[model samples]
Target: MLHLDASSSSNSKAISDTCNIDLNSIIKIETQLQDNPYDMISLVFLLYDVPDTALQRLIVYQRVMSDVSETNINLLQEWYCHASSRPNWQHELLEALMICQLNSIVKSLGFHIPTMRVFYLSSDPFGSKYINPVKKILYHACENIDSTNLKKLKKSLLSYDINVMEHTTCEIIFLELMSKKFITINISQENKTDEGIMYNVENIVNILDKLNGLKKIVNSLRYLQSKPNHDTIKLKQDNTNYGVDDFNDLFDLINQIMPNTLENDD
Candidate 1:
């Protein structure tokens, strides 16, 4: 149904050809599922892919879940397990597909689905380290201002698998949506104190400085880790020493900044 036409190079033709086959396979699989909702073999086969089948596979699963009654829960669970055991990209795609389908089902059925429970029970691992591909789907789904559901979804997102940049992007989108629908936080100017103001400013500056240092360390570590086959033992030892030094410096800085507080505590 969706055509991918990118005429950048010779490989474009090959990709298009593969996509055509993928489309046909998706159609056949959908028809089989519709005819026999219990067809686990066809469902499992859908998890397999060739080059350029990402979009095709996503479309097929979307169509399949558009009509929830056509899906077999047990078979879907098995398919999730199969997908999770594959590469990270495949796992991310499966997560996005599941979120899309669950949103559709919720809208159609006018009820909330326990997506978190389903994910946990299916043993589909999620965390902040993994990237989320369905952020837009999630953003739109929560636009209805169902506070209860939104709260639950927010908690679930803690384990919803997103990288640092994606997490920031999603938070911005969420804040924008909430701004449009709800009142912003209000603080009275009369309640401000000079001591409190100074403390808050110092805290903010300290946090920013620490974050800048941490970012540098993370970038350096990423570069070093990516270098092919270097002395791994030496690298590990160097990193361990680097981390210990950073922690010591951090603690010393904290002690210097809050010496009076530490004395009072003692």
Candidate 2:
């Protein structure tokens, strides 16, 4: 009878230990995510409440504008691969997840929500700190541009021997112009930076001035001698660092944007 009781007691302890072990075990997010790339990518994107435009701008700030994917899953995957190669990648992933309010994912990865605020990524990485006012204005004008005016603007580029394709958007056009040195930022003073950066807005302003609707957007800069505080411009910045792969992606975009021009050179 005592042997039977001892056996039952030992069996109970084993069951209790098993339960505690199950409760204490940590499940890694990567382990679950590794096999489900599509689902993982989609969840990140879906839960990533930040606007897609903001993400695109961040990509541009990182100089990986070419990786801009219209599709969310592709964009997330590209961003994930880029982030993974960087130092402190896990921290960054945690930061992003936290920003997205993805507590479950964070916990799954064995990270607790930081009690104190830790900014792995600033709320605005690509804001005024990096992009001067002139570039900021151009970015805003580009963002607000409509398809009709975009087509007109592209058609006008033909006169300058720059053929902007039919499918290209204003954002792409702006990037191409910036890449080719058609649009440039000239910083006048090391200090007093508010008035330091000068915009040679001539080429782009002139082109936009010719287009009926776009004229109102960029026309004010036409008369400003040095400091033009165009209230029409609003700025948002995305801060990310680009890797070699990202640079390659950007180069490909530049190539795509200026394919006709490149062929003409040959």
Candidate 3:
């Protein structure tokens, strides 16, 4: 019988984690695709990490277009011909092509605007990294908008019977959204005849809530993509932070979530 200590167990887990997709294999497949643009086999292997349904749709679109028009076929041929030799191929042309295809599919399927927005955000490789802060702010603002504290502040203003400008509400929302640590809203009242009352409201929004919102959005997009029927899809409303998720984790998650998408043809 073998006995394992805590340290040894941890080491074993680390070793198991190393079995993810090989970076060298990705590079080799990319090179092979560039060398032979007409190789559908290599193309499929290169797109091994994408969702199965998305890959199937692309294949079906390609087959349909091939039979539809000579001009369209020539255009695709030219596109791949250019892609094969293009420098910085993955980041530059590959992303653009994926976005174009996603856009066309969204339009053809008549996906609602909200669904379109979610897909568009997911398609952006830099979205999670760049938009995290903004998402967090918006999430927190939504959570705090009608809080009892905020309502009390509003009641205090109404008791003073001061006329608040429409711009004042906009300013309050803006301050709430832009706040990092705490938001302070101040207004000054001169007299009973004064049109505006003066007061300051301070509020704190949870950073964790914002991070959780971002995770929910990313996960929702993944769920939407995996479903066969877009008409029945519904975004989850939970605000649980899924972990300290990042772009690298997102890529790995996608690969893990759709493992059957990458089965090598026999």
Candidate 4:
């Protein structure tokens, strides 16, 4: 009888330990997202509980941009956590974004850490609305094969890490996007920033020049096309250093830069 009691007690302790670990993990996620996620990336992936009347109007104003999926949102948050911690986390983001159909919406979810706010704003505030025809090349590249395609894309994406810093490299893609010319943005900066967070003409010109340098590989047709110099951008995510929450920062930035861009809830 004593042995049976001991066994049950041991089992209960084990279960309790497991539960505690899981709970801690969940709390960690909440803290990371809420408290100090901005140190990792300028753009944040998050949701808001605020009244949606204002957000809904923005959606209607924008011709009902595609919906952001819950699964992708979770995946992005997970990726953000990993990317903030581990350097190799980009593979997960690239793969997830590739498989996720809600790329358009996913692209817009940037968070500010200070206030725990979420905003939908374009990253490229001043680039032209131009596109490279071969972007489909990347899409098709992923479609034609099996594990090999995934492997190749992973390799290609990860290859950028060979020279550039981990998370900061993602900023380079924004420059690449501008070079492709698929972006046109109008940003209003009430005040100036040393970071040039606003999308003004000078910002556009500086980005274009820096972007061209990154893609200027010797004689290679594949990547010779202009790409943003991944090395130029610095990463901002650090738990130790405090800043605005990803969600709030994005909202404030968008609200400040493009006040009319998002429709008011009322």
Cα-based RMSD of the predictions, in order?
23.3, 20.0, 21.1, 20.3
Per-residue lDDT of candidate 2, residues 72-172 (tens digit)? 23344444554444433333344444443445555443322332012222344212211233444454465567778787888888888877674354544
Candidate 4 lDDT by residue in tens digits, 158-236? 4343322222223233333333332222212342222322122222233333322322211121331343212111122
- Deviation from native of the Cα of residue 54 in model 2, angstroms: 14
The 10-residue segment with the lowest total lDDT in model 2: 230-239
lDDT of each: 0.30, 0.42, 0.30, 0.27
Report backbone clashes per prediction. Answer: 0, 2, 4, 26
TM-score of 4: 0.23
Across residues 88-190, which tens digit of lDDT does each residue of candidate 1 receive? 4222333333433433322222211232224312332222112221122222233332445434434443443321232222233233322332212122234
Clashing pairs in 1: none
User: Which segments of model 2 are wrong by more than 4 Å?
Assistant: 1-130, 186-198, 223-225, 228-266
Instruction: Show model 4 residue runs off by greater than 4 Å.
Output: 1-81, 84-228, 231-249, 257-259, 264-266
User: 49 in model 3: Cα distance from truth in Å?
Assistant: 33
Score every model by TM-score.
Answer: 0.19, 0.36, 0.21, 0.23
Clashes in model 3: which pairs?
A: 187-198, 187-199, 188-198, 189-198
